[model samples]
Target: MASPGIFSEVRDPSERVRQLCNYACKVDIDEAIPPKRYLRSGLEMMRMAKVYQEEGNYESAFILYTKFISLFVEKLPKHPDFKTAPQADVSAIKKKVVASFASAEKIKAKLKERYTAIEKKRQEEEKRIQEELARKQAEEEARRKEIEELEECKRQEAETKWLEEQEARLQELKRQEVERQRQQEAAAAAAVAAAAAGINSGAPPNFLNNQIPSAPPGNLSYIPNDFGGSTKLVDIDSQPAGTGPIIPDRDLKKNLLINDGPSVSSPLPSVDRTTKPPAYDHFMSTGSSSGNKFGLRDVIIPSDLPRKFLVKAEHNTLKNIETCGILAGKLRHDAFVITHLILPKQSGTSDTCVAEDEEDLFLYQEPRDLITLGWIHTHPSQTAFLSSVDMHNQYGYQAMLPEAIAIVCSPKFNETGIFSLSIERGLVEIGSCRQKGFHQHNKTPPLFEDSSHAKTVDTEKIEVADLR
Candidate 1:
């Protein structure tokens, strides 16, 4: 509460002034409550304005100093005791109020500069973040476009293969129709001959008893038993000579070397169905069954193609760590050969793990010149072999390109292997496997074949710009 007489009803000019003086002299200037004396109360406010100025509350301090000057200094000369008060004391309070306002203005200037600097820094940081986001978005879009193009190429390849196979089937059907018609015509001619000779038309021809000229192994000719209706693909390779005329539906026969107009005599080499394909990819120009599927030219690799991976593994900080990358190449007229071996940024380890990155610098290096053919990896310490993880990786590669090959090099163990899954066999089985880590799988007919010949190196050297 205020002091006793601060709000009293005393109104005498001299008597009330003495009472007010008594109240002013007894009031504590430093107390939390305001003093009854305006002089001391205004002086205390001037000190508080200095504190507010240094604390960066410039506006608040300026307002307080303004109120002190208007209420106290404007009324200083009106005070009855002004002549008795020290002139230095009055000057000191005026100087202090002026200093407080000046300091508040200085703080305002500093705050303006500080705020401007903060805003500029914030804008720069925001721009940097936006730029980073744009970069990542562009790289992601590029990778997505690459994946779409690869998928489209695979779709076209599959469609072409399907069309070729359909054409082959249609050709086979036409050959069968021709073969059947030839038998019917031959039967009709035999019937005419028999009837003209005064013999039964339905009876078997006498030529059936006499030995006829044997047809070629592939283009076998047959005369039906008087009535010709149905036809069958003949497997003359399995049939013996003395048992009957051997009929063949082998590739040579399916090629339809038949007597559409006149019969041609061409010898056919015997084929062994049990023979397996070569351990490595090589030109199969024998024109045999194997040549029908793998007719493309043989893939070739140079001896020093993998020197970069070896050198990189040796010089990097983690000497014993595993390394992996994509083998990029292109398809020529007859062969698919490696033109660039891209070392994409990845998280590799001693035995396993090759994490993929969508924004990898290598993804943009190929542009329109290269194609991702397969994968390559180093085992650091272990001998070369496809682990379960390797199987999963190569499965994706082979799906994109049938001729995709896997290369496993062990720099420390001095081992290297180039291989591909045998048919849609082990790799196919492994693709659907639920197990993780290394494990065994039971597969027949062998799982893989050596594909070392498919690799080759170009004169172009590895560029740091490409790996960045």
Candidate 2:
């Protein structure tokens, strides 16, 4: 039972390929084309495929054409009806299937060409982004190296200064030691002279020991010197002293201007250099399995559509009566492009218009594979806005497909607007309300807003089927 209609909603291209395979396996080929209206309905796929191709929706066109070949060229011949059918019917079917095979092949070639160009452009863009990222990375690396070199040079300069200060302190300490040596020599010479005087004058030699002063307590201490019987003063303060008041060093290591490494300098800010390819629109969607909450895809409205419909419905407008038309089209490139504006047989009053025979609309759409995207109507004398009645009417279309829209045109007010019921609020309000025609409802959080998913385009001319 799987058919082209099953693909009306947006789906991933890969999933669709799998679906096609599964469909082929499960399909009962013998029962595919049943008797009664088989001959008439057999051509429906071809008709719809031709419409897709003519409308420039190549993806949908290609799919329909392929399906047509699968059904008629491959499946129909195996059907029970075909085995007992008249020779003329069989001959006619064979001729159409052969022609369809040719059309499908032609469209396949076009699709190949279209996709090849798209892929080439995408690769070029990707290469450009990669090149840009590589260039930036190189610049960051060079900057980091420059900072490291500068910091190293500063560290070397600081180390050299510290060494020079230590050398000077060593020289100063040697000079101080020499001066102490000279003083000790003088004191020893005086003691020896005194001892000689004491011996000559018959005084005690012990007086010489008393004349010499004891060394001071603290970091300073005296030791025996190489010079005659004199004690050399050793500056033990050159090393760290015993526990007492702390003495400041000639050079404090913490205050020295030295660079440890690159960690000292500010690090470069991180940048996200990765880039992703553009999303494939149209028939390709990576949407969730739950389906698009707002429905399939963008619903395209033909530009100046309101004006065109107005021209067709001028008679109704002149009489101060309303006119309505069905906005219908095939899915193209993940969008429902409104290609046909059908003025279905209908009657109207100054405020509202109703289609008389809806069956006529469905009958016309069946063979063409058209989906009802939305509706457009003219409010001859009123302003371009949906009324309470209009809200209820639009709720039905939106309920069927969340992407559906309602376009309101008012020639008298020189206004035309595309609108849709608010899914969050409008749909709920209208769905619950039972009132009819021109009645008021809570308008604080208004029921509808301008359509965001629908856009007017001028790329293709819209076909008007004025069934009236």
Compare the candidates by TM-score and give the number of the best one: 2
RMSD of each: 40.2, 10.5
Q: Considering only N, C-alpha and C atoms within 3 Å, which residue pairs clash in candidate 2?
A: 282-333, 282-334
Off by over 4 Å in 2: 1-257, 264-296, 436-438
Clashes of each: 2, 2
Lowest summed lDDT over 10 consecutive residues: which window, candidate 2?
Answer: 281-290
Report the C-alpha lDDT of model 2 over 158-236, residue by residue, as the tens digit: 7677656545655566566567667877887888888899899997798745477444224423222222222222344
Residue 40 accuracy (lDDT) in model 1: 39
Please give the lDDT score for candidate 2. 0.65
If scored against the real structure, what TM-score would every candidate get?
A: 0.35, 0.52
Assess candidate 1 and give its TM-score to the true structure: 0.35
* lDDT per residue as tens, model 1, 1-468: 111112123333334334322322231111211222344334445544554555554433444555555444454455556666556556666786677556645644654454455456767987997797778778777776776676666666665555455446546655765676588668666766655574555554465544344442343445343314233344433565533233222233223222222222333444533322223321111111123235323344545656766776564424667777666654443345566666766776777746466346333632434555577788887888887678766765554344678888877668878877655476558556667677777645656667633645564344322251
19 Cα displacement, candidate 2 (Å): 15
